[model samples]
Target: MKLIDLNRDGEIGANCHYIQIGSLNLVIDSGLHPKKAGRRAAPDFGPIRGVHLDLIIITHCHLDHIGSLPVLLREHPEAPVVMSTSSRMLVERMLHNSANVMVRQKEEANIPEYPLFTHEEIDRIAKRLTGIPFGQAKRIQGGKDDITIILHPAGHVAGAAGVEIHHKRRQIFLTGDVLFEDQRTLPGAKFPAGRFDTLVMETTRGITARGSEKTRLIEVNRLIDSINDTIQRGGSYLIPVFALGRQQEILSIIHDARKFRRLVDCPIFAAGLGMDLADYFDEISRKTKHVRFNRGIIKELQIKPTPRKLNPGEDPQQNGLYIISSGMMVERTPSYTLASGLVGHARNTIGFVGYCDPDTPGGELLASKPGDQFLFKACNVKTKIKARVERFDLSGHADREELLEFAVQADPRVIVLTHGENEARAWFAGQLAEKLPKTKLIDPVPLQTYQV
Candidate 1:
């Protein structure tokens, strides 16, 4: 088999991979980079310009996985896109939300390539997107070669999957953003128990260690305790989360706390695309039974939409809990603005519940000292870091140990690493080399093809 990493700049952004097995050609994911803007954010598809893409398999609905689907489909019109059944229910909504965000950014940032695709285009292509059930073997033919495809529950988020491919007598597995431990809204991954000829996996949390005390329950309780302390001190707590999975999971956790009377009474504020996704999650829970989110939680919690006009460098007028998006605190996002205001006060607190790119504002702030002078450059707000900045061990990605164990157990002849930074990949490489000295490990550079 031969493969090419199409993520352009590589290391966790614009996750697109081109692979050829036998006579078939496939693209696993086509995502837009979170850091880059406009057209530059998309994966460099120059290598496959005239090449006929036989299939495009999506791992999930996250922007970093499926954001550029329409863009890719525009070029490869004949290719069929397939994902897990749960992802199918959420794909259109995710793409539609992306289109809407792009339109807003086009107007706000004055970028010409903002709305890379439109709602009408998405509507036209939605029918072509197919959903397959887990463990079901679906065969596709290309030329004289035929291969069987199976998707397994990956459990990083709802609809996320690990790809299993069988061609001739060889078997292959691709771990697409996996999480072994169950989350409040979803169960843990249930991968097939067997060996494969080749194994491809994500290394998102390779650099972080999950200490014994940082388990899910402990982190959740700590988060609640922090919120209580912040609210008792008369300040708002800002929780920056990803609009898709993190937001809904946090809501469910919060609902559980409130129901048991463990959480303090406060006005919960949430809005934007995530609130809209609650409806979709509710439907998925009923139809697919893969997730456990209920839209009714929003109403029962008396959650209100955030105030439209939030000022930077000035604490919000209403002191309550603010659940906002752009999890990494990307510049110009609602969480970024609110963070700038809340960080200058001692009473307020900014809690991060998911992974943050080290270059992003959230990561930079987490690295800073309490009294350090922090700057919110996009909003032109500079202030001392007086507020409590904390990170809960509630990341959506699986821990390094869990991932390493799975890889070792698989005992594959070839291992390919993707979806992690240089240091993270380096760590995994060293460990894999130490454990499986004879196994071939390949970390493909961006857009380069390697035979394994």
Candidate 2:
């Protein structure tokens, strides 16, 4: 079996990895890098040039993991893209949103640009998707060989899964993006019964050390306390959040705090698609009260607000708190607009909830020093640094301890860590090498191919 590196660098996008076992070709996670300053960057597709992939498996709906799929489908035309039902729903939303951005960027720039794919390509890929649930095994025919692939709960996102491939006498496991007992949304990853020959895992948060889940609630409440203190002093609280995971987690936690009056009663505005998604999640929890669904507490927090929705020319003095989406403050994004409006205002605080690329506006906010000033383009508001800027490790990704625990449990003959920067990847690899002396720890090199 041969493993090919697609996008060895994590977070930047264009992560395309391929696995070849005899006649069967398995392509995993064809994705694109986020656009910087309105320009879309391409992922490294060098390893897939000479061969045609028979099957494509996506782990989740993050644009970086599935963004390149439509183009790949447009080019391949015959390969089946497989994912979970929740993932399909998320993919549709994410793809359409991304396409809209590309179109808008093109029109605004007046530059001749190629959209990742047409709506036709999206429709075709949607049709080609085989929505497989967790714990099911699918066999793909490769003209000369048969390959069995299994999807196991990854707990990263609603439909994220850890993929396992069984071919001949060998087994390979690929963890797309994992939530190892963080308990943000889904349950922790389910460990497969048996061992595997090789393991491919993503290390998006390898550099960060996450606190215990028990402390997560404490930290969240602490942040809320600070926000409350600011607001009680006649300040506006602005929390820039990721539209999906982090936003939901924060809502659930704050809702619990408010129920017992631990936190102040303020308007928790769920703006953008994040609000809709949160509502959908609450509905899902009501239907399926499974512990796997962390909706029990959230269900109680779903009480109707007093209709505080805002519009153009609306007064902002009425609400005390605002939670908005697309965490990264990019131009034209709702969170960006809001942050630009709130920044440099002494009475307003903007708290970042998730990862932010350095070039984006959100990243800039994260990089702000304690006393530095920030510019708000939308409102022409110059906010002072009086509104506190703080970050809690309320992340979905596994930390060092979690990574070590996972490596020990999922012990394989060889381990390859991807989706992290150089320092983080190296630290993880070194840890594995020291702890698991018998296992061969591998760090992915850009476009390199290794036989497993």
Candidate 3:
């Protein structure tokens, strides 16, 4: 088998990998980089431009894993796209929102190629999608070199999966952005048991030494206390979250907290694509029962929607909770806009619930000390950091130790690590070297192919 890394940047953006086994050619994901724009956001498709891919499998609906899908479909219209049923329901809306974001960027960022793919194009691409149930093995190619694929729940988000491929006599496993522990909305991963000849995994949280030590219950209680403290001080709280998994998870936590009287009754507001995605989550939970979330939680909590644009000099703080998207607080996003107005207020608090790229606005705010002056580039506004800034370890990815333990248990002969920065991959590699001294570990070189 031959494997190639297609991500232009070595980090966690534009996550695409190509694998050629016997007569089958497959691409694991086609994602766009959240930190970059236009062509730069997409994975490098130059090497596989004319390659006839038999299949493209998307493990989840996150933008980083499915954003550049239209580009790939445009090139290889014949290749069938496979994902979980829940992912199919979410990807349609996610891609449409992505197109809208790109269109806005055209006017805001001066990118001529903004809206890389139109809604119409996405509609066309959707026709090629084939949703499959978890644990069901489906054959794609026939004859002696037949290839079959099975998807197992990966637990990062609704419909997220780890794929197992069987070709001829060999088996390969790909652990797409995975989380082993359960969240409020979803159960923990149900990875297929046993070993494989090759294992491809993610190392998104390997850089942190003690990331896995903190349990979800502990973090949730801490967040509850923080929110309670902020509200008790007559201040509003802001949680900048990703529209998909984190939003729903946070909402569920807050909803339960209020139900148990752990949190004071306050107006809860959510804006951006996350609100829309939550609706889909409710639908999926009711339909499939795959998610443990109550469908009526949003309505029960009476969560309000923030207006598209706040009025000039408007005070968003009514001593309530505001949940907004662009998890990294990308410039011009709802979170950034709301934060600009809230940061200077001494009584408010802004809590980060997930991973933030060090270069994004969210990371800057988190790294800033209280009373520091910070500039928000999108609005060209400067504000003092009077509001409390805190980050909770609510990461969706499995912690470094958890992931290492899983890898060790799987015991694959050859292990390939992807979807992490250099430091993170190095950390995993060092640990693996000590834990499994004889096992072969491969850190892929971008645009290079390796035979395994």
Candidate 4:
């Protein structure tokens, strides 16, 4: 079996890899890297064009992982896009939302069009999606000679999974994105109770430090308390959050804090797609009860006004709590505009809930000199430095220590690391090398094929 690299970079519009093995072709996550000028750099799929894809598995609903599903399905309409039932539902929502974001980006950037496939193509691909339950193995073909596959929970997102392929003599485990230990949103990935010939896993946070979930919750609550104190001094809280995991997790935590009276009442403003995405978490909370919903329950939270669509010069209510998308203020999404409008306001606090790439505006704020105040260009409000900026350690990906433990548990003959920048992947590889010297570790370059 050979593995092909399809978009090795962390960002979409970058390079991508596609794999072909025997009569079966499997395409993992396909995405592009964003160009320097904000255009998407499409990956080359010429190598796998003629090959028939027996199955396609999506790791999670993240745009970088599922962005090119439409592109792939548009070309190979006969191939079934296989993923978890929950992922199937989530991706359908995510992909459609992605199309809307792309359209908005084009209009905002004044670009005539984005080269990515249209909404129609996304719908076509969505129609071909086949949902598989966890632990159930499906045969790709009718005969014994065909590929056999199993889906296991990766514990990254609600329905994220790892794909295990049993083909003749070899057992290959492809961990899409796993939460090794102490994950708050979902359970840590359970190692398959068997050995494997080759293992393909993503190293998104492989080189970083991750603390325990309990510790993180404590720290996050403390930070929220400090911010709330400032808010009591007439400051508002601004959180730039993604519409997926982070938003839901933060909302739940804040709600819980409110329940225990650890946090005070400030209107919780969930803006843009966040308001809609919270529906999923609310459903999860109601169905599972595993999620904590104290006082600031999402279903009870108020919806903030869409300031962008409002009259050009209108300001959002400046007194309560608020959360918006584009967690890093880099994307021209609502969160960015909100940050620009609220920065320099002495009566507000901004808290970051997720990892912001160094180039993003949120990153800039986090890294900025402590004494420096952020400038705002939108609302033209230059208030005092009353907003407190802090970061919480509620990361979705597993860190270095967890990665080593997970690797040891899997105990594969060979390990291939994907879905990280070269530096982080290399660092993770070095750690893996030290922990499991006997196993062969591969750091794949884009489009490079590997045989196992």
TM-scores for all candidates: the values are 0.98, 0.88, 0.97, 0.88
Clashing pairs for predicted structure model 2, backbone only: 6-16, 14-43, 344-382, 344-383, 344-384, 345-383
For model 1, the local distance difference test gives 0.93
Report the lDDT tens digits of candidate 3 across residue range 1-452: 89999998877999999888887888998999999999999999998999989899999999999999999999898899999988988898999999999998999999998888999999888889988999899998832366889999999999999999998788889999898988899998989777788899999998876544567888889999999999999999989999998998999999889889898878998877887777788888988778876648889999888866763223576899998887898888888888888899989999999999998999989889999998887787788889999999988898888889888887888999999999999999999989988789999999998998
Cα lDDT tens digits for candidate 4, 1-452: 78777663442234345655566777876654533323344455666787777777777777667766677777777888788766765777777787776677667766665636677777666668887877888888722357788888776666678888887888888887777554445666665866788888777765466555546657677667866786688766777887777677677667667777777777667766666765665554555442332324655555455445522222354677777787767645667666665555556677887777766668877887545765544434343344466787666777656666667777889998877656678887887888788999987766667775
lDDT of 4: 0.67
Provide the global lDDT of candidate 3 against the true structure. Answer: 0.88
Note the residue pairs that clash in candidate 1: none
| lDDT by residue for model 1 (307-387), tens | 899888878747799998989999889999999999999999999999999999999999999999999998899999999
Displacement of the residue 181 alpha carbon in candidate 3, Å: 0.7
Error of 1 at 43 (Å): 0.5
lDDT of 2 by residue, 1-452 (tens): 78877764544566678888889888888787765322245555655765788998998877778877887776677788998656765677777766776777677656356476666668667788877867878998887999888888777666777888888888888888887665645677775855778888877776776545536567776787877887787776767776666677777667767777888766566556666676556644454331233444445654333234433222366446777766776655666666654554566777776677666767777788766776654434454444466666566666667767777777789998887777778778888988889998777677777866
Q: Cα lDDT for residue 90, model 1?
A: 90
Q: Report the Cα lDDT for residue 42, model 4.
A: 47
lDDT of each: 0.93, 0.70, 0.88, 0.67
